[model samples]
Target chain A: MSESRGPGRRPGRRPGVSDTRGQILTAARTIFAEKGFDKATIRGIARAAGVDPALVHHYFDTKEGVFIAAMRVPFDPAVIVPLLLNGPREEMGERLVRFILTVTADPQAREPVLALIRTAVTNEQAVAMIREFMTDALLGRAAAALGIPMLRMEAAFAQMFGMLMARYILRLEPMASADPEELIALVAPAIQRYVAP
Target chain B: MSESRGPGRRPGRRPGVSDTRGQILTAARTIFAEKGFDKATIRGIARAAGVDPALVHHYFDTKEGVFIAAMRVPFDPAVIVPLLLNGPREEMGERLVRFILTVTADPQAREPVLALIRTAVTNEQAVAMIREFMTDALLGRAAAALGIPMLRMEAAFAQMFGMLMARYILRLEPMASADPEELIALVAPAIQRYVAP
Candidate 1:
């Protein structure tokens, strides 16, 4: 149970610190896949990876962090939560819309998120994993931070989520081709009502 | 090509009227998949089905109707467009939300639409086909009927589209578990802005 050794650990087989990170991620994926987001624990992941629990905390800091890293999510809540909170309450909608559109504007950045969504739609386990993660990690955190009701925040998120599908996945125009500013102007007030109301 | 016979038709092998309808649907699917919604014409589908273009029109009055039949869409725009137009303009948002949620509430009704969406997210041809059909037959028609910009209507549709994904596909709660009326209240006003503004 030591940081250096566990039942699954073999002597003289440690590649390095980076390898430890890889092993933890590998174990995290398995644990997350098997138990989903809510039930998967850092201690469990660490045990599965043959490392101590402290090392899991040391590497990822939190379960949300571990999920984000493991999933290669395009946006970080650590960065995004502050971005939403630091801005003026009135402008939060515009900021949120712009931020999402900007991040997803890049094909490379958008693909993995789209892949997750694609998986979530067809696969029940993926849905559970993603739903729990988004509810707890992203929307729950932001709703609490903004002092908004979780349902209202989710409504706003759902609107944005749909827009992303229309614009990117379905490529429905003028949504797909409209300038980001135009979308912000059209969608911001609606989002602001949920977040700031 | 005649209604009774064409190059692909075999002599003394006609099944029945229902078989012809099935043949048209099958051919429409192939034509739509190959040429997309915009390019796949009644003539093309009829030619592929080994029937007269008049027979295609007689069976399914328009390309949109054919698409709906071929795809087994849960809702029809012929019914939906009038529903949007006939209502009090201010309440169009509520009507739209209620209708969508209600129709999709049935697992039997919802699955094919979800399957199309699932196909759409990953498949370029599906996206193009759905996009054109939606833009031309559904949103475009509704927008013109209501004197709203097509872009605005599309944005509204996107909001609802995202909510459906959140509610059903992702089953994100309380979005998934919340009362339908609660969602209609939270979302209707946002939809009204784009739709009735």
Candidate 2:
């Protein structure tokens, strides 16, 4: 219980500086990574961060709140929506796969993806959030722009996500270690056909 | 703790036909089905079964042991290996996919498949078991028989299991509702290509 903040009082009491909140996020990310979502506990995080559990609650009302803060996986349709929205129907799969590989291959984007998969099986809320993020940001924008039926959009996601989960999450030997380009090459067409005009 | 067996063994004979074990399996199955592993607890299963925690432990060494018993999923590689081992190179995909879909479509085969996925996320041992089940029974056999490398085999599994996880486990619309035949038709060729000579 190293949390110096008295109950209900903001820890920093300083404007534009949130060192403690940042520390908490750091601690939460480590714990979530180490223990996964379900097994990691608030008490454990507070113990790790050297902060009061109360402060954790104050900063984040629930575990889900902490998860959102810790992961910070942006759900903005802003960045990716236009990628799918502006694409030609026939080329959507190639574009989508290429975009995904680019996003995931970037160092910054990789960690959140790892966190997402780690939590999907361990936390129902995280699983729900993943589905929500996909449906709201990527799939919804995609199906609408391409004028494909909603079902096809979901099918495409199922295929795409399954590949990621199998390759990255489960670390299945073949897919887990495949050359990204080869993976993209094989999978891109499947994606293309799913939403293609 | 409504256990038939109390602390320190009774001198009398054992309970008839192991009624409590059956009860525990039932409760565990229900809990696992409803909660999908992360939330299901042995204590909870025992309580639901009107038995003591120790009795639950007595029957199954750990929660995992309980899970292995309760889910009762057939994780046989030897039985499944032969089915996949036969047939010409060209028809392997169709034969393999047909076998998987047809078997899983059956009520008996489906439950264990669900249980396997549900538990794989929450329990490390469950993950190990599933990995063994797939590798030993299915993946390794296919790779060895087809003379493909391990990496390609894993990639194929990523695709196959990914499809199964998305379509069956999450039951994410369209896929959950799609005709199995249509799914096999679209995806079987991909599976075939991955495994074929």
Candidate 3:
């Protein structure tokens, strides 16, 4: 509380408010990693950040909203979902694979995704969040853009994410640590087949 | 302590032993399903089954032993792992996919597997059991059999299970209703590429 919370604090509430939000996110990341998505409660996060619970509420409307911020995920369909539908239909497989790989391969983009997948398996709300996000934001939007059945876009996600989970999360075996080129070469074709006429 | 204890480490003792073994297995299965693999306690299982806590010990040597029995998963790697690894290397993908789908597609087999995957995310033992089973039986063996680095094999498994989870558990859209032949066509070739020379 002694230090100005603002970017250029002159001992004011507004300056401290900014610092408080940053502290919350940093504390959230730690708690999420240590205890996992389920056990990382808002009260715990508040305590970790040395902030009032009310301040936590002010920043994040709900626990879900807090999680969305902590994850740093850009789930907006407006950004990339349209990209999925905008391209040549025949090239969808490669484009899709590339888009997923490029985005997920980034370290910054991965944590929230890993959290989503980890929690979705057991927590009903997390699972609902993932499904809803995919349908409303990414897949559904893409399906509409491409003029394909919405079901097909969803199917593509199942196929893509299934491989991702097996490789990334479970780290099953050879597949977990396969050569990227080999993976791209082999998988691109099937993906191409799926989207190509 | 009324009946003859079966031949084992503890040595000759009670007679109602056989009945208690069955009870332990029954209790273990229910407890494992309800509480997941790790949280379900041996003493708790015995108590639920209405028997002496020591009775479970008189039969199964450890919690892991009870888990194997209750899940009806084979303890030995020599059996099921080979199914995924057998046949020509080039067709490993098709062979493995066929084996998994055919073996697990039955309603009876599918129910327990769904339970295993669902719980594995939340429970340590469930994850440990699956990881050990995959490592000792399937992945490690497959790596040794095919003479590829284990890491690549691990990657392949991530892909395989990722697909399975998306397709079977979440039933993601088109994949949920995909024709068996279509899925096989799309997935097997990629698997073949990952595992083959």
Retained native contacts per candidate, as fractions?
0.77, 0.38, 0.44
| CA-only RMSD, every prediction | 10.7, 7.7, 6.9
Tens digits of per-residue lDDT, candidate 1, B1-197, equal: 11333336674676577678877876776666445455578998888887789999999999877877876555567888888888698899999999988987866456546656665665565577778878888888888988988889988988888888888777877888899999999999999899899
Q: Which candidate leads the pack in TM-score? A: 3
Structure candidate 2, residue pairs in collision: A3-A52, A174-B151, A174-B154, A175-B155, B3-B52, B77-B137
Q: For candidate 3, lDDT tens digit of each residue in A89-161?
A: 6766877777767676754455556666666665656666666666676777777776777645654565567
Winner of 1 and 2 under TM-score: 1
- Give the 10-residue window scoring lowest on summed lDDT in candidate 1 chain B: B1-10
- What DockQ does predicted model 2 obtain? 0.31
Across A1-197, the per-residue lDDT of candidate 2 in tens digits comes to: 13333223554564223667765666776678667787788888876666789989999988778887766543345665577667576676787888777666654445555566567654566677766656666667767777887667765676677677666555566666677888887777767766774
Give the best candidate by DockQ.
Answer: 1
Task: Categorize the docking of model 1.
Answer: medium
Specify the highest-lDDT model's number.
1
Model 2 chain B lowest lDDT segment of ten? B1-10
Candidate 2, residues B94-175, lDDT tens digits: the string is 7766776776786545655666665665556567666665666667876787788766666556666666766665555566
lDDT of 1 by residue, A1-197 (tens): 11333336575676577678867766776666445465678999988888889999999999867866766655567877898988688899999999989888876456546656665665565577778778888889888999888889889988898888888878888889999899999998999999999
Provide the DockQ value for model 1.
0.55
Q: What is the DockQ of each candidate?
A: 0.55, 0.31, 0.36
Off by over 4 Å in 3: A1-30, A33-37, A68-75, A82-108, A147-155, A163-168, A171-187, B1-30, B47-52, B68-92, B106-108, B111-132, B146-152, B177-182
